[model samples]
Target: MEMKSAVAALAALAHEGRLNAFRLLVRAGRPGLPAGELARRLNVPPNTLSGNLTILSHAGLVEGRRAGKSVIYSARYGDMTRLLQFLMEDCCAGSSDICAPLRDVALACACEETEPS
Candidate 1:
């Protein structure tokens, strides 16, 4: 990802509500939740969640598709992975141990993705 896109994605996730919403979508996997369901899960008003989702969408961290009356929101995994790669591109600093935790996180996420939800 470009520096500008990475910055925009980071800025969007900087907000508490937006971050929470993004995390929820990420955990939800491919079958993302609807806007109303997201608000219900987060215990926030629908409009509030909608606003946060807009920010996430603009940042390329999330995408929504119209499903009848509801818009189903899902995290853009490719974009998210690219952003992480951008942040970690210069990592390690000559210490392999320094990047071990990141590897662990990726492993955990991979495991989670494999299991049935």
Candidate 2:
């Protein structure tokens, strides 16, 4: 992603509620969740949730689709991976061990993705 897009995405996630909502959607994976369910779980009022969701969606962190009467929100996995790779792209500093643990965590997440939830 370009610097501007990355900055926008990061800025959107900087807020507490938005961050939490993003994380929750990430964990929810591609299946996502309805806006009402998300609001219910986050204890967010409808109006407030709408604004936060809009920010996240604009940031390319979240996606929503209409399913009958509800809107289901899901994390954009490709965008998320690109964001992470961008953040870590310049890392290592000649010490592979420094990032080994984080790589392991990334691998673990990959493994989880391969399995059925």
Candidate 3:
């Protein structure tokens, strides 16, 4: 990702509500969660969630598609990967220990899928 794009994505996630929403969406996986369910999960009002989702969508961190009456939102894995790569492209500078924990967290993201609430 370019510096500008990375900054946009990071800035969007800098807010507490947006960060939590993104993490939840990531855990919820590609099927994602409906707008109502996501807002309910975060205990935020729909309008607030709508605004947050808009920021996330604009940053290419999430995408929403209409399903029936609600929009189902999911994380954009490719953009996320690019952002991660941008941050870690020179990570550790060949030090295995320095990057190990980050690798572990990334691996756990794949292995640990939350059962829907």
List the candidates' TM-scores in order.
0.92, 0.91, 0.89
Q: Count the backbone clashes (under 3 Å) in each candidate.
A: 0, 0, 0
List model 3 lDDT by residue over 32-63, tens digit each. Answer: 99999999999999999999999999999999
- For candidate 1, write residues 1-117 as lDDT tens digits: 899999999999999999999999998988889999899999999989989999999999999999999999988888888888899999999999999999998887742433211
Rate residue 97 of model 3 by lDDT: 99
Q: Residue 88 of model 3: what lDDT?
A: 94
Q: Which of candidates 1 and 3 reaches a greater lDDT?
A: 3
Off by over 4 Å in 2: 110-117
TM-score of 3: 0.89
Whole-model lDDT, model 2 = 0.88
> By TM-score, how accurate is candidate 2?
0.91
List of clashing residue pairs for candidate 3: none
Query: Model 1 Cα displacement at 66 (Å)?
Result: 0.7
